[model samples]
Target: MQFCDECGSMMKADGDRMVCTNEACAASSERDSDLEDQFVTTESQSDDDVIESTEDANFEGKPKSTDVVCDECGTQEAWYTLKQTASADEPPTRFFKCTECGHRWREYN
Candidate 1:
């Protein structure tokens, strides 16, 4: 990951140069030829298959299940959790996340 020297914003690859992602920062620098762009990908899984997951730092330790489907991607597996968004007497909201495409949804009991 590269950062802009002028505004300290994150930089993305643009051909052989590292261009700043910040719209306001026009800073750019030459990229190393040896530094190849890395892209991690995963194979799709069936609805009744194993719970798919990633090694992303933020995704670590999150509980997952296959009880829901994503409206955007139609994946049948997802990571799930619950939260109390309403009054104490009310039921907690059940949130769901698509394991395939990272889509989020919620359910009220």
Candidate 2:
């Protein structure tokens, strides 16, 4: 909302001074503190704000394998899980649960 006093054209803020847009009357002047087109500012937000949280996903599904046979029920399919029961250089131990009789067994590696 600032106007060039010399050219009577619109004035734009450029750093600390205001420049006229008119090509014929290229006038430049210092910025006014009580000008209409002063730098815009916003108020700081309050600290009291609501925070949101999310629930953990359900990771309870067990993987099934047809290769692992159940000893108690003689089933061909069973759910197996691996655990690091030995040293870091060795392989992990596999725990198997029968799908038919719900029998559990562990195999060390």
Candidate 3:
């Protein structure tokens, strides 16, 4: 018997596997299937992916865009976040809302 690391629930060892009694434990086989991106390192991934990851740290509290001229109302700037997709085939997008007019736009990465 073993205890679950996440919920501290009891688990029973069956053959080669240990299952928690909580019945909510995630199977290890499904963990990798939920990966948003397969690339692990910038040196080995595509240029776009590398650039996206580099910008992630700056997304925390950074302005939407540098010298970004709002096409709708000529606003000065806005705030944004680093939005990532499940894969490279997925769209690269970011939210940009006008601080003055509240007009939002999705800037694709």
Per-candidate TM equals 0.43, 0.43, 0.36
lDDT of 2 by residue, 1-109 (tens): 6778897998776777888889889899988777634554222345233221112212125677788778787899877767677899999877677778777777876
In order, what lDDT does every prediction score? 0.69, 0.68, 0.54
Could you tell me which residue pairs clash in candidate 3? Answer: 36-86, 92-109
Choose 2 or 3, whichever is better by TM-score. Answer: 2
Put down candidate 3 lDDT per residue, 31-104, tens digits, no spaces. 22333264243245464433223322333344566556666888878666456654877876776666556566
Worst 10 residues of 2 by lDDT: 50-59
- Please give the ranking of all candidate structures by lDDT, highest first, separated by commas: 1, 2, 3
TM-score, candidate number 1:
0.43
For candidate 1, the 10 contiguous residues with the lowest summed lDDT are 39-48
Q: Write the per-residue lDDT of candidate 1 for residues 1-109, one digit (tens) a residue.
A: 6678899898877776788989988888887766654521122324443333333323324677777778999888877766678999999876677778877778889
